[model samples]
Target: MSELNVVSISAAKLPAGPFIARHLIDGDWRQSADGASFERVSPSHGSVVTLAARGGLRDVDAALFAARQAFDKGRWSRTSGKERATYLLKIADLIDRERDRIALMETLESGKPISQAKAEIEGAADLWRYAASLARTMHGESHNSLGEDILGLVLKEPAGVVAIITPWNFPFLIVSQKLPFALAAGCTAVVKPSEMTPATTVILGELLVEAGIPAGVVNIVLGYGDPVGAAMTADKRVEMVTFTGSTAVGKAIVKAASGTLKKVSLELGGKNPQVIFPDADMTSAVDAVVFGVYFNAGECCNSSSRIIVHEDIAEEFVARTVDLSRKVPFGDPLDPSTQVGAIITPEHQAKIHTHVRNAANSGASVRLGGGPLDVPGLNGQFYQPTVVCDVRSDMPIARDEVFGPVLSVLTFRTLEEAVDLVNGTDYGLSAGVWSENVHTCLEFARRARAGTVWTNTWMDGFAELPFGGMRESGQGRELGRYGLEEFLEAKTVTMRIGRTRTPWVA
Candidate 1:
């Protein structure tokens, strides 16, 4: 086994106390109706990070009412594209200006590396900028060729009162992905970020108000999924629901929304894979495998947790991957050099460990560290960089979304077998193939079941490209033109040029 990559523990000064986070309703910051609040302990520093509002059904009702009013009044929904673009641009500038403050809170609240949080904030700004451009470029279709006397038109209009429920992981970035697109399409929203990571989203609400978004245009409610998310999804006033979280929760949201039959968009979990051919660049493939599994502590929905390597080179590749995984910096998130941070919570940490333990007990080889690590100065949960090889295709760890820094290795002899291994799980979020031959790469790309396929890379994302998954991974896309369309409904307008239609009653 290689030495654990225990980098310097962060000695950064702790905050004076928990940051007070409140709900944003109708352009005003307010507390919960019941005066209930929750405390979030930093998963890295083991200190109280945020004291956030605990919204209930009543809060959800108020937010929904505000969003419904905003949409119906049409102050924002009926605004011209250029006008909407102006608001988004202002928000983007504010995001850039407040990146450090948001990043610091996100790191403390979400247990992500501060550097990564900062980058996500930067990327989120770019997403807003992209959505701004989309706002300006939005258009409708005109069909003058229908007839000389008659013309048909297809107009795109907003799907009002969107309910956005984002998960704890990537809280700020994921909300940025959904909210800006909805706003660009002239939709009002009620947002419920995960209770664990609500501070950054609240900070975003401040930015939104500072950018001069109208009252009730984007109301935010912070609390648990039961009363908060549930109420948001089931409310009759909400026309659409866009969520990013666990597959089980996503299914429940779908069932809840079925009562109203509102439009639903989900970006759920993944056990993504990276297939490595023998002829691929060994160094690059190995590096990517390490980065993919360990990035964001493998809490991400798109984490490349599994790797399918050709039998001819499986041994060498797995060895290289294990070695590289050992070098990934794992320690305090405040330390800029740490690449992997603490697990979000002790419960999640236990879940990650259970998966690895069950796999090892079921005859898999634990190549590297397979349990929790002890950080010198932190009292929070820290998982070791683990690599599991000799994994059977049917093993739980091989197929389940282990959602930790645990890498599973599966071997395949042929391209067919590789593709099968990649598609074996219920997830089809993202997959990658490493190959030197163009033909091999193209064929694998064609055969992969995932929504996003990378030829020689993994998890390289852009605001211009559409992203989501198939099967149990998710439904609907999150970025680009499709993202804007997710919040829009098409209306057909047919007019007779001279009112020359025959009267059917006559």
Candidate 2:
């Protein structure tokens, strides 16, 4: 194993050794049972950042056992809603208090710009606080119209142990989306964060402990997806499994979880579209399109990688978009001014390049960048923001989720054609429509098959609104009151107030 190289962020108030990361199991930190470990390399410089313990099947078993024990023993499950809310609030408070440290860690591990990292950290804190408020407000419905002699009562109960498996793109943000809601719903969880970026999630485990979460209420397992993640899905004790990653892996998780028939929720990949009508504001559309596809280096699941523009304005719009794409600053993730950062891994970077090359080979015009980038003092994986024009809707680049800073431009002649182009892919996670006419916006919003449709904007999300997708983008929703309901089961209870026996019972 290589020695861990420490990176100091003097202005961000980080700890001495920001590289060392560990797993949190049953409210304590420990090494894997087999003593296996992996090197977590920094994406900014391709250097060994830390040595994270590589958990396997045994660790997954321990985590599942812990979560099952906590749920069945009613340690946290029996707590009052207000008590749970209080703990969640404390966790939110701790997140805010240590925002700087956590944000620095996230930037180092994920290679997202420091500014974006800070925003994500604060957003996660807000999500926890929002979930805490929901904990107190969660209530069951009462049906009073049954009859005077009969009564019906509906109750909402937690769904036993939940397995939360998050991706690497947004470590803290994505985990916060599910973990707090599960805790608020009175469900114990075993979290398996992506091995590539596990530091912030592990740090979150520490805060959960400080906030007085009962032992085994929330366990963090660190390792690859094969044994650790697969074990979690196959375990019968885990009643629910929620995952956020590629659609391919999501399908495998669903199949494995079928053995025990676990309730599963997936937030999968996307090849989302941004439709720019000719009547739209060109400046605003171009700016929003750039930010939509390039934010977080286009690693977001809902990134608008496909831009369907009206043929009338395609030429000008493509030119402006290409110009802006070339100007997007790509450098150190720690730099606040850097708009784009290094790719998560070399393999992923290679995949991005291959996609771009194939697009070119398929006769799509490379309007801007079409290859990797090299920055002084940085030997990490980095790809330039690319904009491809004259792309056919049937091309692989236009249909697949590149998960990189590459945008494919396609032209449409009419509203029906635009909607068809947007819905042509297997994904329906998110879509954006830019039009000044309210009728056009409303029409497109209604016709688009996506779960979330934005008008004149892109990638706008709120804690109070439900977010999810249709078709291959995945099932179930995240955030808002709906997110809390995902971890709960509804039960109906009927009582006889008068004569109990039915006529047929005699």
Tens-place lDDT digits, model 1, residues 67-165: 888899997999999999999999999999999999999999888999999999999999999999999999989999988998999999998889999
Best by lDDT: 1
Model 1 stretches astray by more than 4 angstroms: none
Model 2 segments beyond 4 Å from truth?
1-18, 503-505
lDDT of each: 0.92, 0.89
Instruction: Please provide TM-scores, in order, for all candidate models, with all chains considered together.
Output: 0.99, 0.96
The local distance difference test score of model 2 is: 0.89
lDDT of 1 at 230: 90
Q: 152-175, model 2: which lDDT tens digit per residue?
A: 888999998999999999999999
lDDT at 276 for candidate 2?
94
Q: In the order shown, what is each candidate's alpha-carbon RMSD?
A: 1.0, 4.0
